[model samples]
Target: MPRAILDGTVLAESPNTVVIEGNHYFPDESVNHEHLTGTATETVCYWKGTARYYSAVVSETVFRDIAWYYPDPSQEAASIKNYVAFGRPVQVEL
Candidate 1:
């Protein structure tokens, strides 16, 4: 199983996760929306398409752009669509 944590809080956990480039992409339902805030941030990957970012708020601190997901991935990377991946400042425990 994989879990996403921040500031001692478990933000998301799932047994079914997709690993791409060493990052575990948790399914949409596994993410806890309560701790997330939408950000006007996006970056494009040549093969993954557009990735949307999100900020996580925990213990009064906001970690910006620490999480992202591709809602409409390129055909080659379609398995991760709608799945979320967390980066530094946020921890993914396996």
Candidate 2:
């Protein structure tokens, strides 16, 4: 199982994760929605399409743009569509 943790809190965990470019993309249902705050940020990935970001809020701490997902991924990366991946400030454990 792979897990995403922030500030000692588990944000997402799943056995069905997609690993792309060394990052584990956890299924949407496996993530804790309570810890995520949607952001207006968007970034384009040549292969993955546009990625939307989320800020992880644990207790009183907020990690901005620490997580992202592609709502509609490119054909080559369709399997990871809508899956969440963590970046800096968010720890991922496999």
Leading candidate by lDDT: 1
Whole-model Cα lDDT of every candidate shown, in order? 0.93, 0.93
lDDT of candidate model 1 versus the reference: 0.93
Give the distance in Å from residue 81's predicted Cα in candidate 1 to where it truly belongs: 0.7
Error of 2 at 32 (Å): 0.3
The TM-scores of all predictions, comma-separated, are: 0.97, 0.96
What lDDT tens digits, residue by residue, belong to model 1 across residues 44-68? 9998999999999999999999899
Q: Pick the candidate with the highest TM-score.
A: 1
Total colliding residue pairs, candidate 2: 0
lDDT of 2 by residue, 1-94 (tens): 7999888999999999999999999999999999899999999998889999999889798889999999999999999989999997788888
Model 2 misplacement above 4 A? none
For model 2, the run of ten residues with the poorest summed lDDT: 85-94
